[model samples]
Target: MGTWLRRVLLGGLLITQGAVQAAEVTFDDIQPILQARCVMCHAGEAAPLGLRLTRLDELLKGSKGRPVVNAGDPAGSELVRRLKGISQPRMPMTGPPFLSDAEIALFEDWIAGGLKAGRNPPDTPVAPAPLQRPAAGQPVTYAHVAPIFASRCVKCHSAYGLMGSAPEGLLLNSYAAILDRHERVRVVPGAAGASELVRRIRGQSQPQMPYDGPPFLSDEEIQLIVDWIDQGARDTNGQPAPSPVGARVRLQGVLGEGWTLDSLPLVVGPGTRIDKAPEVGDYVEVRGRWGQDGRVLVERIRRR
Candidate 1:
């Protein structure tokens, strides 16, 4: 081979190796970057766009009840927007939020690679099970609740992980630990009104949990969690608890599958939707009432 051709071929080989590195955006690469530059404010009570760059699950969950990284759509992902300095006040606010060329390339590669979530590779495998709900009125178990905490809270509170270092020694690493410290300064069960966790998410208290504002928790999610805790906070097989008042809604007629009354007052039927008590002909339901114009209310739907 000619000398010049040999040089060109070697350069092409190096370029290929670089491409492989770019394709490997793992937790190790993304986590520390977020924890150091983003998590302090974004983890809880201080996020800008409700985007929590905290945990892998939270990252996948994304903003506005949607995934920020839509797999191969890097241009559509908010991560790209913030990183590209496209939005006002470029991220890392103070110091240069500069990502190395390699880092940026890695992110692009990750996006192209399905934006795959969880720990990387087969060695540190992540469970592929989809999100599941525990049976209502059951005692809270480690398996079920861990995923919740891991998804929602542990992002900032756990050490040896991304998000912030343990804030004031509040360790959410285990169920025993969380319960042991439940009533101290934060976890106030049976009283969502007084619980710091509830208060923080509701934005009624300062220094909000999740560190991100407004978009942190949906009104429905916050209420469900609070109600769960208020119901003596039971797990997989406890006695039934009283259903929440004013927040209940009944379903009627043959509805689509995968729909539930977890969040009441959800719009149903065609054209119009209402959460509160609806009048007759309005096609609404409040605690077992199915009528429009708020006149008569019907009981919960019975299956054939």
Candidate 2:
């Protein structure tokens, strides 16, 4: 074989190897990059343009209009375009400390690699049983709504909690606290549609509630809150309204960073139980209370 032909063949082999290695870039490799640079705005209901970067599924599902990352096609991916400034309005909307070239390259490689989801630790637990809804005809009041806030709104809004500063001075930790805050009337008795709480959760308002989501509250959960507000937003025994229990989220995706499933953080503790060692791409079920930090404090996990 000619020396020149051998050099070309060797170069091709190196290129193929690089592609194969790039394909291995999974959620784990890219999650920190996202958490540090993207989640600030991309998290929660208020995420601009409804784009959520907290999970792979959210990225795949895209904004209310379209997908952000196009698997196996970094050049065509909106995420890539934004990072490279090929698209109008470059990302990290808060940048001067924009993603480094190396960081952006990681994302490019991840997309090129087919966007492999990351794996979980061996001891990662399975999902728990579904949350049971409150019995029919229960009065919607603080008793019912508090749990929702406990699991979903307190991490950021609580007077003292972790997961960064609360936005807009809003606090959802207790009944009196929420009702007493007149800075912005979040709930108006007998008017679900008029309530800022309802509007935010329903995406009628700019940015949404829960602030971190593509997995916004389920329809039933939203209805429960609406019913509570529509019935006069009382503490209890005022009137019957829908009351949903803690949410039980079951998803299939590679675990990434801490106890995250598909980019959604999971807070596991003494109450959490693990059945078997779970790996990346292993479908698992997680049952727990969704926290204000947008994490699930998993009580149980079932690997299938």
Candidate 3:
């Protein structure tokens, strides 16, 4: 994440909710309206007037030459006229009126308010300081690993229980609970090649963690855990360190160098749909276990 990109993202997050609640013209509010109404015809190859309502940016920006709205000018905007049943061949060409009066009112109010940019708020604020990893020779203390777990893993694992089955008597809710497991599979420092914890994440084991969706941990995140374990898996109490291992599992992804990619994993994730063309040379990461013959059954996929 570059500083400028992070700043832009932060700025977007800071003002997104207030704008949505106050003005009502947010991506969250507008997206469903477009998808339910406009996307029927104004998407894919049959896009009308070169318009695509699949994304907020495209909707706000409008067609190739025509602007969707004059910001706050409903009267001057052609979109308003068409939706008001005044223009020829009205939108959502079939079925019931896709939007209620309240929904239309939102668009009107938003346009009248100068089409403000939307934001996605941060649930838990992350400080600007980069998270520090353990030193090469140091141990993976509970204090050090706990923060990382809390930041990433705990969101899903804490409540919905992605790591293991709750009824099966497995839990990672706390460091002590995790450490006291029957197999103690959490971490084994100084043995990077024998850790089941690492194996599950790297896709060696069945049914990956963060099971809610695709794109589990990025390579960087996986590397951080590996580095911490390689140093030594220790508790904050500075007791004897536990060993860690690296599984045979590997994560494969497309990387955009100076070359082009012809193919990539199109369908990944358990029982997920794949129905789009990946842009040529676009990078994607896939997690899977390496077979003896070097084949892999991809478990998850995400952008690189």
Candidate 4:
């Protein structure tokens, strides 16, 4: 064989050998990068989606709500999508200076290599809890709503969010932040109709929420939020939020759904002071505010 041909053949052999000898990726390979960039938002009890990336076990466990990384399927992992900005809010929350294309590819390789950074893969990994929809008629609370916001809304509305700008000054990372009384009134304890949050999500108001549309929140997901707001937007403890200023609804229906006058459903609790007992067909006027369960807690009822 010619000298030049022999050299070319030798170079090709070396390249093929290098590909065959590539080392398997391990947890140690990705730890430093995650520790520096992701650990802040993904560790401890308050981690969004309870995705603590501090250890191999935790990373394997993935987000409590969904798989952040899918073993051998980089295309399926949310972590890869976020790092590449294929998903919104993106990762490291604060970036520009975001993970480079090379960094993202390294992550893809990690996932494609069965997701064990350094430790031996578990015999049977623990599957993280799925984001289950609440059962029918279950009273909605922060537990049900927080995940929705963390996954969908906070991307633009949080301080550490992508680009770090709350488009319309709405920040929903926490219950306090969501409830912080602002001029826009994102949530109104017992009034879903009056809430800007609901309006935007329902597409009733301009610039429909989550800001990222087309694949908007599912009907079930949107209802969870509506139910939470209509149910007095309570915390995890489920205590009654202070009622919204009651409207003078002089409803006169046959007590089917609502109104002492127009038939609006009113919650006549043990503490309600009834005046002049009214028959089933009688008209009445009710004065009350929002109750813990979202119904109008009647303070005073008079048969009209």
Better of 1 and 4 by TM-score: 4
Q: Is candidate 2 or candidate 3 better by lDDT?
A: 2
Where's the lowest-lDDT run of ten residues in candidate 2?
122-131
Task: List, residue by residue over 1-304, the lDDT tens digit for candidate 2.
Answer: 9999999999999999998876578778887777655664566675556877766677778888788888899999999999888985565543433678988999998899888777954222222123234578855665555546655666567544345455777767556556543453556556564445776777755467787666788897788787777777776455532222243333334455667665656788887887677656666656555344445667877676
For candidate 3, what's the RMSD? 21.3
User: How much is 27 displaced in model 1, in angstroms?
Assistant: 19
Worst 10 residues of 3 by lDDT: 258-267
Local lDDT at 18 for model 3: 69
Using lDDT as the yardstick, the better of models 3 and 4 is 4
List TM-scores for all candidates, in order. Answer: 0.34, 0.36, 0.34, 0.43
- For every candidate in turn, the CA RMSD to the true structure comes to 18.2, 22.2, 21.3, 14.9
Which candidate's lDDT is highest?
4
Off by over 4 Å in 4: 1-128, 133-138, 244-304
Sort the candidates on lDDT, descending order.
Answer: 4, 2, 3, 1
Best by the TM-score measure: 4
Each candidate's clash count: 28, 20, 15, 16
Measured by TM-score, how close is model 1 to the native structure? Answer: 0.34
Query: lDDT by residue for model 3 over 82-151, one digit each (tens)?
Result: 7775664344443132357787776777688777556643121212224456576665555555544544
The total of clashing pairs for model 1 equals 28
